[model samples]
Target: MPYNFDDEMIDEIREKNDIVDVISEYVDLTRTGSNYKGICPFHNEKTPSFMVSPNKQIFHCFGCGEGGNVITFIMKHLNMDFVDTLNLLASRVNIDIETKKTKRNKELEDRNKLLFNINKDSAKYFYENLQNNKKALSYIRERGIDESVIKSYGLGYALPDWSGLLEYLLHKGYKIKDIHSLGLIIQRKDKSGYFDRFRDRIIFPIINNRGSVVGFGGRIIEKNGQPKYLNSSDSPIFNKGYNLYGINILKKYARGKDVILVEGYMDVISLYKYGIRSSVASLGTSLTENQVKLIKRYGKDVYLCYDSDEAGKKATNRALEILKKEDVEAKVIVLKDAKDPDEFINKFGLERFYETMSNALPYMDFKIQLYKERHDLNISEGRIDFIKEIVTELKKIKSPVERDVYLDKISKETKVSKDSIKEELKYLPIRNYKDKYINKNNRDNNKDRIKPVINRLEPGYTIAEKNLLYLICKDKNIYESVKTQISPEDFITEEYKKIAERLYEYYENEEFLFKTFEKVLNDNLIGTLENIYNTQINIDASQKNKVLEDFIKTVKIKKLENKKVALKERLKEIDLMDSKSEGDVEKFKSICLQLINIDKELKLHQ
Candidate 1:
């Protein structure tokens, strides 16, 4: 199945970066010939309608009508940045992208690799030390961890000597510069040497779903160390906010069961040890938007088992904020008396931990209880404030049924009438303003792809420009006339110009119009092109001159209109960022006026 790319290593990378494989890493894909199908993971569905294609290297979901290629898949599924998707692909294909001389993608790839390698090497060092070092073994034994558990987690240790890891890595053929740059080693500014950053610690390798060690969590083995634990600094590949310590190992458990989210690695290990397998811990930090997205993709029901300590409760509130954003079904498990799930289990029993997991309180119910804990509800002011807070949050629920249900729960707690709550919601700033805007204008566009603005060329231009361009490539006669008469160079629209350039090159190569163009241009461009080719054409075959003249005129007009709109949008953006007339408002106004003049000129030309 692996096809040789004939020395086009980048091409090989691009080809291997198939939309199916990229998507399958996130979405559970079912094979359907050259294509695969799965339910659209971005949204909920009853039937499996998301389709992925390896041959064409595109994916489309008929249920949601979401469609795109591998890059778009990452952008949508992972909710990653553009450069991040490219870097992920490049890494998969083992491409060595240089940071400086290369383009933005390459530089990002280089930085990403440096960051990943640093974390990986650090994890390897930890694993090695755990296996060979006596002090680390003693530390593990003291903690009452069996050898089987340590080996299961692939745990390791950091030697007492600061230079132990540095020397070992250097001998293993890792570059000293990369080792320092990756934050695996601390380099002295006035000196020329590097030393191990994590010293005399029992190391835990933080793994991702693909099972690559992306970061390290080091526990102090020596009693003299001030801090008990030290985690790797945030890198491009590893964010403490986004990662879970043992999600890679626990993802299998997470897949089918309600996920049990614990606070620490010890908690996860303990839970797993007791056969409560569907448990994972956040990366020595609070839950983040990225982490929420990751968890939501894997499972629907989430149980948050944070430490019973004050800091853990604070972390719980912060995690609640992110999960609220993701709109997931989450509950909080209160681990009473003990510091965390691990200690709680060890102190009480696995039975108690299981009971806590099963009886995890609904996130809102927990928060409501938190409010009750803080305030005396019988007090009129306290009740009023509590009712107001509940109503405010309840109004944020767009679903009427869901809102009413929660309102009923609020009424049961605070003795507030449902009608009164609904009345209060009428005045609350809780409408889905973004959904309203998107619904109004987003009908023509696919939400899966991110386009700042939709195409809005005039009626006279749309049929001819898109049609002639489509037919020119399809039929040789049309291609010749267009090739000699009109070049993309003379087009007014920078967007259409780019489109035309891609078409021009494709036509020049005498390539077929369908799969060839789709492969060359990305999913967005391909969709646009397909729309051009497939959409209803209004012009007759005879009206070449009239169509050309009208197309040219509309293109210019649209360009001017777009420029004016952009100038207006930019002025508003500057106003917001400046928030006052901090920068040159007059300069922005000047551009707006110039845009207006261009519109007038376009009108005259038309």
Candidate 2:
């Protein structure tokens, strides 16, 4: 059965969830006019092209062409699946979602729960193994790690017996089927019973970015095992690429500070030992897109403190390439050539590593220094090659003044002319300063870009519509004043109708918070609200009535004009049907005349 979503519910949601408030949590929105504008988080746009319409309960970005309601915004911003978005919002609104009794959602939900349950139980079991398990005491002491450090990271151990964990879990009333579902144990091919997946290993729990244990990584203790390390396979809840080793563990320390990005889990632990609290490991995979966003949400800057050996350099360069796209500052620590952070700390101790971090160069400066060492500066062509290489790196920088400063530094290093470097800068594909200078912004250009399309309405009509929605959304009296005489359905744009529909349904709940609407409105409507919020308009008392009347009239005119066109198209359709009876033809003509009369009545000025 289809769950009916009434217009009143939509209105209630919109009134409860203001687009600006919802958007502001994820983005930095600055008030523009009737709406708020910000850099579109959806796409790479330096200029603020994304707008949120509090009035329309929608958001739209001109850059990416994404327009939607609060629900859609949550779906896009959070990267949540649609059902997740629905459930998340439903929970917020105190509305219950009808469970999909279908096999698929049920299977997926159950699989996730089982995986979650396994991770939970496995974490407790692993921690117990670490504590007072006689078999793992030698493994713990060999690392020279104090017991406190072990406990702080929740370090754990896996028992030696092949069926130890499996047997215990079964005794706890977890079915063998459910144990298999958790991916903690595999099916036995040669034997009748199941066995433990990981045996006699030192375990490091893999927690999700949300701080929930989703998987585990195990390091072998016994010399007999050829593979030194093994990580859990992907199940319903975990993707290794998306999961970093210490993001969940070290996020609070990273927040409001620069994070130390090291290569391995031990490097992260070693840094913490050295009083460098803001460090995390990439969990044996390259730093991924999901990882970048996760870090950015926590820390404002990232210090790539990967190894200094050849392999480490390669990893560092690749990390720099990926992290640069996130619009945050990143610096690479080249670890003084001989060893990794752990090796350096073990040899020279913590002071040396802290000095290295302090002396770290900006990534572009480091890239220039790297290429400079490759070419002989004395040779003219070699110097030119070096200049070209460094210039390419420098040109990638968005800030022009910063680019020029580096260009000067290169001029000193390579003896390349500063003017020559500036001339080379012209060819780089970057937005020039004048193009993005927004303050004291030109009225015509800004207004020209802002006009709503009543289906592309001109700036003036957009202003009128924006003001009307603002009034209707924030004040009930304004909504009631127009509700009897004006219909938002008469407004041709889908965005207008959505606002009207919400208003028609809502206007009654006194305790509603407009910010809560993002929970329930669809993405499309959220986007529309964002755009309406972007448009400049007056929702003030003196201009409210006049603007409302003008907007209502414009919508009515558009509606009537469309109706007339439909009538004309209907007559042409009748002509095409040769089998039409004489009575039927007469009736069609009469109905067309009545439609024309109704259209004329609709267009009357308020």
Candidate 3:
């Protein structure tokens, strides 16, 4: 059901949910002067560049240019839609939104409800089958899975019979097509009948963030099986790339802790049983950008606990690249003398696992170590090659202090001089180093040119427009007076013009809060608005009038200067003609008069 929320109801929701309070649930904000500061959740930064203004009810990240109000923050942070964010906020404020469901939406909702019911029943059937199947139960029990742990995780088993799930679903009054759509049963290719998807395997029901069973993953109990693990194919409700295996439980425990990303379900389940609850795994696939984004919603830091084998290291490297691209603070956990987390925890116990986690190497350090082992640092050529590769990796470090620290480490390990390493770092081009590691053939040709950092400063006219908007946003009286003088066209930048237009609309509706316009603004415009709001304009009540007057004058002067340039160009065209008509002469005369008037306006501003 979709709700048609009126402006007043939306405003009421915004009024009740304070931006600072809402953002505090995800970001750790500390008071810094008049604003709250934290590491920007949208990107990785050592410094606290993410600022939230309680007075203005808006947040701005000076690092990544992510800015918005409460609802906007939730939408970006949680990767949810506008209506979903509104409903979530409404729930927080104890407001029930009145929604009308169309026939199509109602049917979709009913179908989804049916799918959920089918998945739930299938999970129960598998669980009961687990208890009756001695071999499956013994295999699970031998792997250190207890009864309580099994129940908590909804661990189950599929009987060896092919028609086990098919017969059960039919008896439960679920259509075969519905069960097939849920990935519980597979339709026969010959169109003869349907068969169970999972048979003779231990089942792990995949639950979504909303606590609904959406799919399943099955693993063979016996060794040397053809396929070790089988997962449900992609369905309407389940996207393995977007959802983590144990995130439903990980979200609860990962509030203030770093999430441990493993490669298998047993790794997650075992770690959870060992009392390390902040663990999640991708569903039998490689790490993805969407999954990384999902992990970021819970915490900024992540620990990659994949297997320490050759393939595992490659997977870990790939995951590191994805996490780095997503601006997530990631570290790699290397387990010794064990195949995976399950075996490591079982062999070394939880204390040693904790120690290993505490001693996990930073991503750069891990990469350096891996490269050192790969290159023969015993010889001069090997050392030179290693140094070049390490310097390339070092250049990716954004913080000067962190880069220097690693430079010292590389110097100590390779017996190379720190000065020589620093010199090499200075010469290395600022290319995407992750691409070099991920794809050797995809290296950029223009690696000698340094990549420029994004500039946050707007142009002169843009600055004036933003200043004027800031004034209008801060004071309602200023909004009315400013609106009367300057129109949205006065803003030179298109983004600023859009913001000015929205501000006028909100002001017309008597909704003064900047948050009231968040739902209507895009991310870039929201960022612009936040930057404008966050900018400190040192003007008293008496001086505010003068400042607003000056800004308006500057905008008018810029507009007039643009008009003068166009008129002068037209005059040049008219002069270039061999024979000018009487109307052309009159037009040239009109342009000259307009240019003179524009000059006078510019002089007045000056």
Candidate 4:
């Protein structure tokens, strides 16, 4: 449960805690003009680029582009969430916040508590079953899982009887519907009775951060079981996507060390058994955005040790994409002779696995190797194709020297001249050779060649949109006048639109204050707002109204122009059709009418 803090309360908490004083606890700061400068704690930099403005009560790092108010600074520096950070700052100032929950929230919390209790009881029942069943105990012992380790994970077993768990839970005074809702049991087709979901399987209870059982995972013990592993379905308190197996235990020993992300429950268990405490597994699914974010909270550097098979390689690629998108640095551990971490450890022992982890490939190198496997390098065409594929990845590299190094490696491998590859990459922004020559038909067809995407100057409407948002945030009256004509939706840039949305919402309660308005934005969004704030707006008071009017008109006209472009493109698409249906004809008429109206609006705006 989280405490509810209103804007006024947030303001008070912020005011009591000075940005400089709060940040000084974590970073060493020196006075520089009106602002303070310090080496950025968020990223590695020798020269100081982190600045804190006491006047505005905000901090920004030019190197990493992380900027926010005092609360945000604590959230990033300490790796705490908004609520926890706020609560911490509140405690610092000795401000007591009353825990208030809405009726619906209270009901939900109560339900979650009941569900946790049921899961705990069910886990205990399974654990007791494991102790009595000699076959189950032997199976686990054969896997080299010790009794202490089993107790640490709360590992258990479910009897083969269909209603074994059902009978036990019923005997313990738990209702059948409540038990079935947790996915521990399944209802019969005729709705006559319910049976246990986990039967003759080794049960792995999924514990959350608080050490409460939220879900269960079962691995089949019988040889003939169809699905090898079965997990609890999503319920009120458990979402498989939102959690990782063994993360609760891993957190205690992580200590800012690199995390090992594996593919299976046993992979994590095996690593932990070998004193590798910083490994966690995705809950029988592809790595998710939430799971990546969770990994980021614990540590930034991650080692992805998925299986070595084709499906495993695909999953590794998918995980890399997510981790890259989230800005978390990741490397891939390539295991030899073994398919997964569990087998690798068992086959080659722990020290060899450690050596493999130490010799993990950088993501770019792994990607290059993966691409090499996709095409034959012996033939000239295959080499050309491989070079093209590698260039697409190389373009993402920000440094020219780094890009050139990879290009040199590709040149040596494919026997293609480095200068020729450089030329192809030089024109890559305008044309994708891979797209142009994906297949024989496409290469033969010249029209399939992509048009040059010239990097043009920013549109006038984009500038106008940003300037208007800046002015609106500076003055509430300007926001009131602008709201009647244009909205946050009219803004073209995503960051500008987000600022407008927050600004509009904040103005409803109170007038603009830099520190107070900053409360509305998340950590990622604060940098954009700060950059906008730093921009020089030099319009004289006499010319302010006229400038605002011009900006509004330009934005409105640009919107109409966008609509016109879309309708014209739709018309071209319709023309390409060999035959038009009645619905298509009607759609064309509607588009033409809309375009005519847009033209009229454009004329008025001009």
Candidate 5:
């Protein structure tokens, strides 16, 4: 049996959990007039466009058109299904839900829970092992990590002996196949038995945003080890690309401040220990787009604090491009005479590290300075090339004021005339000012303009459908009255038709809460519906009935017109045939009669 939640139970869970409190955990929202606003977690934008209404228990993003109630938000944000999201909320509010689970589902769920327990037990085993292992303990202490930091990060050590974790998990009643699936134990080559995956290493458990120990990162105690670090392979629950090392702990500290993005696990732990708690690191991988968006959910600003080596510089450049795509503000931290944050903080006191962070350069400034250093600007050719590059970068700046400021800076630096740079900018190719993350799909579509099939529907039809849906969402009476007069087929757009059908179902049940309807809608539909609901169509109370009537009439006329055009096209094909059968003639006559009837209907509506 599948888990089924009654409407009343869902309603009770939603009523107990406030939307503002739930959303605030993921989005940094601030009160804006009657509603709270924050950067949308769905899409990247600089200005705050995501709005949450406390009174309505709904949220809407004006920028990306994402809107929905509390359940919808959690489902989309965490990428969980309806039942899982409901269970999570129910647990939060201390409501016990009677879930119907099949034998297979129950087995899988039990296995997953056991995996979590195994990881927890493994972490504790490693922690106790660290207390006994003097070499690993001394190595961590030498790296400036204290006992408090060790306990806070759950630092541990794997014993030198093989089959340590294997024996422990097996003693705890975990099967070899299950432990192998978790990447904690490996099957022997000879098919004899299993052995521990981690041995003679310092262990750092990788926790997810939900505070679950999903994976682990290990550092070798001996200096002769070939690889300095080893991370858990991809498993059922953890993907290195999606999980950050310290984000579970960082979120609370990064609420209102910019996030400090470092490169390694030690850097994050060390920074957190030294009072800089808003820091996280990618787990043995390059910074990914998913990681950047994860950071965006916590804060708008990101400071790149990777190592100062050439590889680190390249990594920073790659990260900046991805962050720019998401419209996140990025800055580069260049430490003097230090390779990374750990060494910098260790070499100089915490105050010096804070000073360097405070004086971090904006991405563009850092890029320009890097370019200047690469080229010999003393020569005329080199100077001209530098100026052209600066102008190209300046064009990417969306704001005219910001562009002018950078242009003036370039003019002073290179002794180039501002007018000359401005003239060069005019001849350069036009660039789309929209955020690349949101505009990427549209850009791809534009490249396929030669495709024969295109959206040929009139804009007026879409407007009419949207307006009617908006009006219906605003007032339940409007929805109830309109559903009886017009079916969902009357709507031209598929999205609008879906919205209409869902709204009709809700009102038909006499359920007035919009949050109840949110359970059935996905993220995209929720955003679009929220967009429609939030749009203010100012019609006087006395004129709302007339406006709604006119909108319905417009949609009906558009539908009839579409049918007329389609019928005429079919008639043309019929006329072009060499020989017409009696059936074809009868079909033509039928179409003509239907067209006449549709014309009369349209006339009456008009």
Candidate 6:
């Protein structure tokens, strides 16, 4: 359920919480004249660039350009939502917001509480059963998990009886429907009564970051059990994609250290037992964007320690792609002579596991190794294809020094000169659209709510449009003057266009405020706004008009260039037709004429 708080109520919460005080909790701050200054928590910086103005009640980081009010700061730092932040702030000041809760929201709140209670009780039941069952104890001890480790992870076991858990929940006054809703019980095929969902399995309670048991993951005791692992179905209160298996422990133990991601519950447990406490699992599912975002909150450097198999490689590749888009750094820990992390750690002991983790491959190097495995570098044709694939991969590398290192490695492997590899990089058609605007609609999909990072290498026109927006934000007269020349449609990037549109709307209503602008923007757009706002543009009063005109012209020119590119692509498609029909010829001619006109317009702008 969604929260419903009026503007006045939100304002009250914001007023009760001071920006400098709120930020001070997370970052050390020193009094810098009227404002507070501290090292930025968002990015790595030695000097103090993060500023909090007491008068304006807002915080800004000159280093990373992340600026927002107290609420935005808490939301981003804690990875929380709008209402949750408000509630947290309100609680600090002893403000009760229950009066503002809607009926539906209140019902959801109560129902979630009940579900959490059910999961807690069910977990206790499973743990008690495990203590009595010698078979389950032997299996756990065989895996090198001691009694202390089991207690720490809240490990449990489910009996093979069909109604063992169902009868227990009923005796405890929990309704069958509610038990089934949490995936602890299943309805009979004949629609009679419910039975236990996890039978003869080791139960691992899936505790979220909040320390609440939201779901369960069950591994069968039988060696040949079908669907070896059983996970609780997603309920209103539990989403496997959103919650990690050992995140609760990771949050408690990982003190600014690297986070290790694994594939299974036993892997995380085994690693934890062997002193690798900074590890978590993906709840028997593939890595998700939300999980990546969650991992980012705890640590920046992520270590992927999945099984050493084909499926694990694919999973690692998928995670790398997502981590790349989210601008998160990742490394791969490939185990030799071991199928998974559990087996590897158990076989080699902790010292060897540490040695292997220290030698983990960077994501790009991992990709290169995968390519090496795929192609036969001994053959001439294989070497050529390998070089081509490596060149394509190298194009994505932003740092010239890092790219040169990889190029040198490729050169030594295939005996290809560095000059030839550089030449190959030049002719490889850059997938600009895919790289620049990948997953633009990811926010629309619930599976991937984390927004992809905006490419810093935007074209000149896009940068100009962003400057125009910044200028408007600095001076209302500039907004009035620029509105007449270019609207939001003129901005090439979707993020820029949306910000422009919001600026227009806010200015029209006379509601533009730097402190409260985050209200209208989502998390990603807020980041975009901070980048635009952090820019220092100094123009003479007499030259302001000229600068604005140049920016407007640059944006318009880019619009024409985009049209020209689309027209050329369409014309090429028409020419590639097997048989050019009369209509196709006419369409091709029309596109050519459009391209010519667009080129002329671009030249005039130039």
The residue pairs in collision within model 5 are 66-527, 67-527
RMSD (Å) per prediction: 19.7, 18.3, 19.1, 18.5, 18.7, 18.7
> Order of candidates by TM-score, top first?
6, 4, 3, 5, 1, 2
Q: 1-606, model 2: which lDDT tens digit per residue?
A: 111233344345545666677677667789887889998765556999898888777787765556567876786567664446555666666664453234444755676677677778888888987886876877777666678768667778888788888887877767887676445776675658787767778888887766778877777788762346556654446655567777875675657677888877677777777677678877655566667777887776789888776456656766787788666569987777447887777677887777887888888877887787778999998898887777778768878788778887988988878998777756655432222212223433564563322222233234445657755554344666788777766656667677767756755542122334333467667656644533333222233465477666655655665777787777778878879998868968886887869666864541
The Cα error of candidate 3 at residue 399, in Å, is 1.0
As for model 3, its CA RMSD to the true structure in angstroms is 19.1
lDDT of 3 at 52: 97
Which 10-residue window in model 5 sums to the lowest lDDT?
A: 431-440
lDDT of 4: 0.79
lDDT winner: 6
Evaluation by TM-score, superior candidate among 1 and 6: 6
Off by over 4 Å in 3: 1-104, 430-606
lDDT of 4 at 106: 70
TM-score, cand. 5: 0.54
Off by over 4 Å in 2: 1-113, 132-135, 175-183, 186-197, 222-225, 252-254, 373-385, 423-425, 428-606
Ranked by TM-score, the better of candidates 1 and 4 is 4
lDDT of each: 0.66, 0.67, 0.78, 0.79, 0.77, 0.79
Deviation from native of the Cα of residue 270 in model 2, angstroms? 1.5
Candidate 5: which stretches are off by over 4 Å? 1-108, 187-193, 384-392, 430-606
- Model 1 agreement with the true structure over 532-606: per-residue lDDT tens digits: 544322222223345455455555555556677788888777767735563467777787789778877865853
Each model's TM-score, in the order given? 0.54, 0.52, 0.55, 0.56, 0.54, 0.57
Displacement of residue 569 (Cα, Å) in model 5 is 46
* Cα error, candidate 4, residue 247 (Å): 0.5
Candidate 1: C-alpha lDDT = 0.66
Model 6: lDDT of residue 224: 58
